[model samples]
Target: MAVKDAAKDEDDDNEVSAEPTPPLPTPATPPPSPTQEHIPSSPQAQTAQP
Candidate 1:
């Protein structure tokens, strides 16, 4: 049972690390950069708006 559970856990990890999770985590980390970049650009737009 323990061995099966460990194998199952490894399979889960492999599924994540093998495919979908890589891009998910990459995008998750990067998403903030765009928001941060947008914030700086916003001041310029605010002045233009005024």
Candidate 2:
């Protein structure tokens, strides 16, 4: 019975790990820059709204 219970527990863990969690947008977000790239310092740089 102990062995069976252990096997069942392992199976449950495997199923949880196998679940496909939604992809996070964290990676898509650009890293912080010392100088904001979107700032219209030049004629070409357009002002972007957050």
Candidate 3:
């Protein structure tokens, strides 16, 4: 019974060690730059209304 228990523990350890970790998800596209030149100015900038 002790031998069987030891074998079972070894098997469990092997299973835990052999698992393939899932790869981290990748972004579909690169993030936009914070200081990009093409960003439009706010509406407040174009109007004089207070």
Candidate 4:
């Protein structure tokens, strides 16, 4: 019984280590995105006005 418990505990440890961690929340908007967003909107607005 003691050996069985130890084996189970070892398996639990291995599972804990092997389990993949959930992905962290990443910024959906990247840094260069702000400049890209602005660049396109400016031209679209200019065309709309003229």
Candidate 5:
């Protein structure tokens, strides 16, 4: 019925909101930190050798 469809749609919206949103920003934010750290570390080693 109409009520059942509305409930299902609400649940699907909640699940979609909960699942993808947290993980999208999580991987995105972490990758930049590691890459920046690695880049700085490489330059630090070169600086030390010189």
Candidate 6:
């Protein structure tokens, strides 16, 4: 009976001494780019001919 109790105590100590598992790191994501066309000519830039 004493030996059984000693083994149980040793098992409990081992369980307490075991290290915890670490969490996994999250993955990184890339940013989106803008896509727009620019018009260089304005209404004043146009000329009328007779």
lDDT top scorer: 5
When sorted by TM-score, best at the front, the candidate numbers are: 1, 5, 2, 3, 4, 6
Local lDDT at 39 for model 3: 44
Most TM-score-accurate candidate: 1
| Cα lDDT for residue 3, candidate 5 | 100
Off by over 4 Å in 3: 20-50
Residues 18-39, model 2: lDDT tens digits: 6633233444355434235534
**Cα lDDT of model 3 by residue, 1-50, tens digit:** 99999999999988776663222122322333432422444454556454
Candidate 5's TM-score reads 0.41
Taking the tens digit of each residue's C-alpha lDDT, what string does model 6 give over 1-50? Answer: 99999999998887766533122121211111111111223333453221
Where does the lowest 10-residue lDDT sum fall in candidate 4? Answer: 20-29
TM-score of each prediction: 0.42, 0.39, 0.38, 0.37, 0.41, 0.37
Off by over 4 Å in 2: 20-50
Candidate 4: segments with Cα more than 4 A from true spot: 20-50
Checking candidate 4 for backbone clashes, the offending pairs are none
Cα distance off (Å), candidate 4, residue 40: 40
Count clashing residue pairs per candidate.
0, 0, 0, 0, 0, 0
Model 3 local distance difference test score = 0.55
| Ranking according to lDDT, highest score first | 5, 1, 4, 2, 3, 6
Candidate 5: tens digits of C-alpha lDDT, residues 3-38: 999999999999999999999999899899889999
TM-score of 3: 0.38
Candidate 3 collision pairs: none
- Per-residue alpha-carbon lDDT of model 1 for 1-50, expressed as tens digits? 99999999999999878898677788789889898999989998999999
lDDT of 4: 0.76
- Model 5's alpha-carbon lDDT is 0.95
Q: Is candidate 1 or candidate 5 better by lDDT?
A: 5
